[model samples]
Target: MATVGDQLLNPESGWQRIDDANKNIIYNGNWISATGDPNTYAGTAHYFTLSGATTNSIEFYFYGTKLRIIDMYWSNRVNNVTVELDGVISSYNPNNSTNKYRVIVFERLNLQYGFHKVKLTTTSTSNNFSLDAIDIDSNGEITAPPLSKFLISSEDKHYSITNEYKDNAIPAMTSNTSPNGIVDASSFYTTFYPWKAFDRIIDPNGWVTNINVLTGWLSYEFDSPKTISAYSVQAGTTPVGRSPKNWTFEGWNGVSWIVLDNKSNQSAFAGSEYRLYTFDNKVAYKKYRINVTANQGAGDFLAIGDLGMYELDKYISSVDTSEVSFIKHGMDKGMVIDLEDEFIERRSVVKENSPLGLGKVFKQKIDTVKTPIKKASIT
Candidate 1:
């Protein structure tokens, strides 16, 4: 009777699992991303290959002493996986009569603590091969060549919008809308302002455009330039058809708006569904915008529950310690303008200090405000 942690299959502790979606792994083949298997998988997603002729393989560069390869074990899945670590090869057969998800098909331990490459290849891919996730030593990390250009989200100083819908003729702050935070949008419906999308709320009340305003945009301006590589959009409550179907994520130079990513004819979203889109963006930009052109057959308006931008992972193996030190030195010298002062002047500020170690203390400050910029209708 082999238990979950028996036979050194799955580690019971001291292991960190990295999802298949992590950019560190290089997948070679037409690997399809899928979910909703009969049994739950790691991160509820897996990448499966369809081609039997092609040399389907996946390579993970890691710095660790132990590793575990997780995959799907199911009936009719006839494939032989060969895992090559530092030129040493080992084989495993995941084909089983019973269905199981997140099965540790391969495990290796007590390796030299240094950089290593693990290449998993399907030698006899009579059917298909599925990769769920990989587990590594708790102290080790996925090590790869550092990316020169990536995008990241930093605190911005300003936001703007173009239009907003109001139910009554009076112009005053409502209980539903915040009067503080810098946000701007091209258009919005009653009580649903652009800042609502950035408020970190997952409720029904979100940013909505005026009726029939198909083409609109929401822009943000940062105090300094930032490299952003990914963005996410969360669906609002009910009538998901109102979500943006066609849109261009753009960054603004001094002269023009450069399209970073363009999506069209997107499927309708489910309520509060969060979707992430990643693209290659190396250059830093001071301004960014989401210009939407169409909705998912919602003839009345466009709505979004939330939106967010992200930067590349600043992993220790991927980041230069000297560069981080230089940035910190510049900040300590006041070479980079601190937006905290201006932010605190306009809103409530909270500060805290905690002791880190003997004769060492850490300080943190938080500023909260809600303010919006100019708005204009796009007819």
Candidate 2:
């Protein structure tokens, strides 16, 4: 049969031992073996004493979500011991009349994930303090999934301009065109030709098609397929019949243009706010095309200020919550102590080293008890 000490030291058994002999496990005084009798200890010998002074203490560092303190219990000459977890102090009194060995003195579970420190100090010198071992729950490390990339239409660099309103001073269907057509050139009524609706600009002075074109379209291409859930389009200065009224949003899934959203009879007021649209189902594609079939007014012209697309936000659905119980020694609960100063940040640096062209990840503090929200999703 495996001895109690054997079980406490076994990694497979989910118990980690911190004893007097460990160099990292601080001990302020001399080590002494138990004497004077009918011992209740479970190992080679019963109780062993590690002499403690009023100021004597043992401190150690650990990384986990839960911690448990184990110590030897004797009724005869035991004194009160103080325990601190991450600087929060709680006292334990091992003054029971019965002679119990290898008892749990204190335990704290469900702590935030990260590195932690624990300290045990003797408050009274009348009797010596006995520390047999300290056992920690084995499963405490956090395993986070790889971070994802944030996708937005602004990041795209390629597009296919269909009906560009060309001007002698300004380029036609170029990304440089302001989505709102608000550039300096737009101040002149005759020269106020904006680039094209697909140029990603919202400048009020930007492009607009000649009044009365039966049908028109603009296509955008990205380096990789992206998942889009919502889109918005700003109307140009001419919000009358020149604005698009009926249109279809399509995506190229490497095969054909798949219709994502079909809007009809849409209205746009000249110099009014942008019109926004959301898709019921999200789809992934490398190319997106907007086909305008009808204009708001009888005129065939179509005016678009700017256009944009965005992906949905992601979140963690679940996390691991396995529990590991600690073997009781003599650690007590409910002894009040003053709270220590809160931990302060020593420095700030990038959380991860991502690929040169890929996006980066930022560090954030989170509550383990609540579900965490993530801005992006992995492809």
Candidate 3:
């Protein structure tokens, strides 16, 4: 009895065994049995040999998301084999000086779920073709997500203005004097380093100083829904008094904000560095916000230099084009008319034209024209 190592067939440790004698496998033409010692051939019972027949082939009908072909490789007698997976032919040549058995001849991963077929044909009569077994993953394959392109930052910076931050103190000298007190959060959106105290480098040149309010918030809206799992925040220049000490991360669920992750009594770091937070589960959302409830030193304002979010995957959905209008030039007004006289002239038939013959003639005329034409153009 053959056993699987991890029961999971992945790119790293490919497993799930199908021996040559499996019921789902079919061998055509004459094949010779070449059984080896258990110690020499990875505890495999038997192997089939093919030679001197171009029609000789082996077919496998399998239910798996991925398939891998295993065979023996030897320089002296091993021959080239034609591998076909789901009707696609892939040629493989095995030539090596050392006799290595149980080699992966070919593999296809991330295929559509359901049953698929694989065929291997012997192409050389002089060389020997050995059939070992096939590796398949019945658990199905995982599709990797597309790469993300959005970046979070303040306004006027590269790929900025796409994110929004609010309810924070505007850094001094960088605020616009609106009807309300100087907007303290302006410096948070600038393209400056050390935007917050927790930044890797403690630079006080630019920061978003919160108002005398204890609880502040920063929020960002992405252009599209993204699967995010981690985020980071740079504290303000004054780590003790203004840096956020306790905060909660929330994501918009189309109706209300839901807490994704939260941390309580988070101590302030001494220097400027981003404090990273990761969620155990991923959330797909377009909006994310961080609510800071307390600061390190009982300060009136809570300052943050920069905020960042990392996306885990992209949302995959199908688009419906049935309602879309696709207009082809010269295809709207073409009319097909069946002229009994024209059909008689073309086929030289004198019988009275029936409605079916007229309809056939009309279809023929339309097919011949290929493009729409004005009714006046028809003779």
Worst lDDT run of 10 residues, candidate 1, spans 161-170
Candidate 2 RMSD to the real structure: 26.4
Which model, 1 or 3, shows the larger TM-score? 1
Supply candidate 3's per-residue lDDT for 121: 78
Query: By how many angstroms RMSD does model 1 differ from the true structure?
Result: 18.2
* lDDT digits (tens) for residues 1-379 of candidate 2: 1222222232224345554344556555554544443332234222334443456566776656556665545575456778888779888777666556556656565464345667777667566566665666464422222123221212232111111111212223454333222221111123335334445555652445544454666555655666665666666654445566788988778777789999875534345345555564446677666677876664545655665666544321111111111111111121111112112222212334232343353334446359644332223
- Top candidate by lDDT: 1
How much lDDT does each candidate structure score? 0.62, 0.49, 0.50
Off by over 4 Å in 1: 1-181, 314-379
Ranking by TM-score: 1, 3, 2
Candidate 3 TM-score over all chains jointly: 0.37
For candidate 3, what is the lDDT? Answer: 0.50
Question: Can you give the lDDT of residue 224 in candidate 2?
Answer: 63
Error of 1 at 31 (Å): 22
